[model samples]
Target: MSSHQPPRPVRFGILGCASIARKLARAMLLAPGAAVAAVGSRSEEKARLFAADNGLDVATTRLHGTYEAVLDDPDVDVVYLPLPTSLHVRWATAAAARGKHLLLEKPTALCAADLDAILAACDAAGVQFMDSTMWMHHPRTAKMRELVDDKDAIGDIKVINSVFCFRANEDFLQNDIRVKPDLDALGALGDVGWYCIRAILWAVDYELPKTVIALRDPVKNQSGVLLACGATLYWADGKTATFSCSFLTNLTMDITLVGTNGTLHVTDFVIPYEEKSAEFSVASKSNFAQLHIGWDPLPSKHVVTTDLPQEALMVQELARLVQNIRDAGGKPEGKWPAITRKTQVVLDAVKTSIDKGSEPVEIAN
Candidate 1:
């Protein structure tokens, strides 16, 4: 037999016990390189309940009554923060100051400026910083990215349209933290539009668009939180993209990319319909058959499979990076934080365009 040893699992401290945190805790269990070491909330009882409800053993896991306690825990190697958008800057910087690697939830902050402060702190502390955009870690996303980059596969992308929407029940509409002005504020745009904007940017190799224009109409709640909206982005090279996001419609996570020589379509871009596999359709070299009764080329579907869910994959990646920093004296990966900044920058642009009454906003290079 070989004399190799198993890798040490990265210890994770979860803060706030947000609804999303439960799913992330499960994801941590799914990743071989990660483990939940502690959980903290304003109420120690709440944290205890969360741990119990989530099947975390109280004897092995520490439960704290305050967010600071979790950050101060020496056993915690990384902090999984799924807190509200507004609270990101304060807590994220605090975590970094304590030398804890951060796995922040998406919509990293309410605005780009806030995110900058958080990033600056992480930089100073030399700690890992990554946003929880789970789908980005999916194997299917890599396959799609490879296909788009291969000129022979789909040629150059000319246009893209993406949407992430789902209807919310009355209770959620009235009381969910996402709809609260002081909590999420950005609402549907932050909740769903984030995925769309990321997809558009990824299609163009993360190039910032030349301009962004918000759609004419957007639905907002009484507190002025966005509930539905759309925006279009223009690249200097003539490539264009549009995306829609909403909480007023049936569930739909779709993306369509039209290229010079071919096209691609994915119905579930954010969350795949099934856990084991995901699919996308592609068409190339279209020509009419004799008599033009039907198209000569038909789109074909490609399915990509993964043993672990995308969220688990995300945790695994962060764990691997954190391990390197902790054990091998390696620096944190810059790619994740860099891409996260780009996503936030683009998001701020869309919000600005909307606030300016749909006037096109120029994106600074």
Candidate 2:
């Protein structure tokens, strides 16, 4: 809907009592066209406590112990899931069957096939679905795209390198979701590497690589803690992209796109906090004059910061969904921002490559 007037707020039902849900609840309060009307948790007591704490214990407010109950609510136009990765497919499917739009966390499903199922279900139900890949929506990332498309900046993309790692808590073994068996199995690739892959996907306009090679060195159980892993992606355009993700390694959060004319470097690529500034730079391979005449030379340096908090991205994503729903007569297209079948295809290829000793796996066209 073309709206100079504000759209009606989208009432949301959140599944799970995830830490991220709290942030989303706060964000929903701040978001212009969204409202958290209900929350569901496995534990009735927990749901009650959270609802009371959030001042949602009012007579009209809804809070329930089971996620299914949240999905059954007629008031909820969309459901935001912050559940564990394994539970994604089941919950997402159920939500879609109930005709509720879905906002899933990153790395939407275990593999591409599962994501496809989630998308198909949503499509059949005529509801929208999207991964909360908020990084893709930020201005800094948009600027990076501009530089990549610039002929003088990086003429023909040749390679990409990215790393996102942080040492786990020493007592991670004691008990933590990150180290849990199933999640650990997904390893760093699904956890953080996915961001790097998706970033490159967006940069290259979602071109699927022709070949992929992955290596996973599990330091522990079947779900080995991804001490370190590397991937080699061969694209049809003779461009090769590679990235490493680790939890046992030193701190690192960076993505560098190397092209023919110049290289674009992005630090803190994935989590561009509104309060914290991210650094971006592009050094042209062409002479200073060529850079000036042929293109608007990128600022030698750029910083990303929003007056809002880190949760602002989530807030913005939800707001976009609400606006789309209101404008489209309540039948929004795509999931979240846009859940495509391609996302799952690439993810599946990566999983197969990792399982087969990082053997080069071909992505089906």
Candidate 3:
């Protein structure tokens, strides 16, 4: 770990007392060097209730009404924005102007231009900016990357097929900003499809696709629900990847990679929140049965099950954030600018392709 001060565990000021913020607050409690110093909601009464429910010792951080007030608090060094996708840019820009380190939820903006502007503002202010693509920080993802790098068992990868779909309950629509039309197109892609894309790109060394073709069901107006969508991502080197995402079905997160010589299978691209172990398979295209060598990557096979930690991945991410801050003497270099920018650009391109009737769009890096 770097020897820098590490920013004193990043006093977190959460914007909006949403359920997800509660989870993040809980995770912050578990994450070393991090704490939910304060939480703000439109209603002070609600914010106080939330703080009390969480047993927060510092009640002063629990403010009511107006997100700007939370950002203005001197006690808050890092602001975790869990507001709706549409509100991301406005709040992120404001928080950046205040010189607070930012941890915004994914799809930083509805379009690439907005994302670029937000990043530019953050850059101008020299604030550390991070999108909460928490899965990228998961240890299992690194394990999967290791598996791919160790052998390239998937062999000259040709296709990347993935899906993240689940039928959310009817009650989930209440007051949820995710169902708005302008924001809906980014629904599944940002919410769940981004996970598939992240896994695929990371496995392939974050290569940019040459061209992308996408399609969405227009007849069904579920506002933000991406009932079904598909993308054909063409790599520069002739390799291609195809992905599909939906929100009209039961929860299914699966990723399968096929290559000329072998195949790699990720049974649960997104597993149970309590997942402790992941089951993966590899075999040559020519011979499938004989080479089935499956083993637990965790401490022990028995202990290696999908019973995940209540605060595992998010806490882990916060730990890394602290370390990253320390590494840069309180400001890291590079700082995932490409990932954050590219994520929005690609998502926008995918939406364009969908609107253009699945016509292919040239993807820029």
Candidate 4:
């Protein structure tokens, strides 16, 4: 038998009892290099119930009555923060200052500046920081990126279109935290637009757009929160992208990229229909068949299989980074935070454009 020691598991302390946190807790358990060390919420009973409902071992998972207690746990090497966008800057900075590696949820902060502050703390503490964009960890995403980068396959991208929408029931519109201005604030834009914006940026290799213009006549609730919105991004090289996100439409998720020589299409871009496998279609060239009945070259479908869910892979990757820092004294990886900042910058610009009556807003950096 080979004598290979398993890597040390990174201890994770979850900061909230949010619905999403249950999924993340499951992910942490699934990841080989991660473990749920503790869970915290305002109500001790709620924390206990979360652990019990999520099938976390009560003996192994400590339940804390307060978030601060979890952060203060010396056994917890990382903090998985699933708090609201508004509370990100505060709790994230605090966790970083406490020298805990951070795995933050999407829309890392209310704005880029707030994210920068959290990053600054992580830098000072020499702790790893990563946003929870699970799709980025999917094997299919890397395969798609490889195809897009190949000049012979896709050539230079000219346009990209992304749409993500889901119909919310009446109760959700009235009671969901996502629709509350004080909680999520950004509503549909932050809830769904984030994935579209990230996909657009990823297609362009994270290049900041030259200008952002919000689509006119955004639908907002009475409290002034966006329920539906869209935006257009323009690059200096004539490449353009458009995206629409809404909470008022039927379920749909798509990303279409058109290049000089080829096109890429994926219907389930944000969340795959199946957790174990995903597929994307790509067409390199086009030719008319005899009588122009059908194209000679048809788009080919590529499917990727994974033993674990993408969220689990995301946790494993974050745990690996944290282990590097803890075991080898390695500096935090900058790529994750850099891409996150870029996504947030573009999102901020889109919001600014919307507030300015859909005027074109120049993105700074």
User: Cα lDDT of all candidates, in order?
Assistant: 0.93, 0.73, 0.69, 0.93
| Backbone-clash count (model 3) | 14
Q: How far in Å is the alpha carbon of 188 misplaced in model 2?
A: 1.9
CA lDDT for candidate 2 = 0.73
Q: Model 2, 95-146: lDDT tens per residue?
A: 9999888888766887777787888788888777767776765667767778
lDDT comparison, 1 vs 2, better candidate: 1
How well does candidate 2 match the true structure in TM-score terms? 0.86
* Model 3 per-residue lDDT tens digits across residues 284-354: 54442345554223211111242334344655555466456644455644547677777676677777888
Assess candidate 1 and give its TM-score to the true structure.
0.98
| Model 2 misplaced regions, further than 4 Å | 1-5, 51-61, 216-227, 273-276, 286-299, 309-311, 335-340
User: How large an RMSD does model 2 have?
Assistant: 4.0
RMSD of each: 1.5, 4.0, 4.3, 1.5
Q: 1-365, model 1: which lDDT tens digit per residue?
A: 23376667899999999999999999998998999999999989999999999989888999999999999999999999999998999999999999999999988999888999999999999999999999999999999998899898789899999999999999989999889999998999999999999899888989999999999788999999999999999999999999999999999999999998889999998899998999999888777888999888888889999999999999999999999999889999999888888888888989998999999999999
TM-score of 4: 0.98
Enumerate residue pairs that collide in model 1: none
Deviation in angstroms for 110 in model 2? 1.2
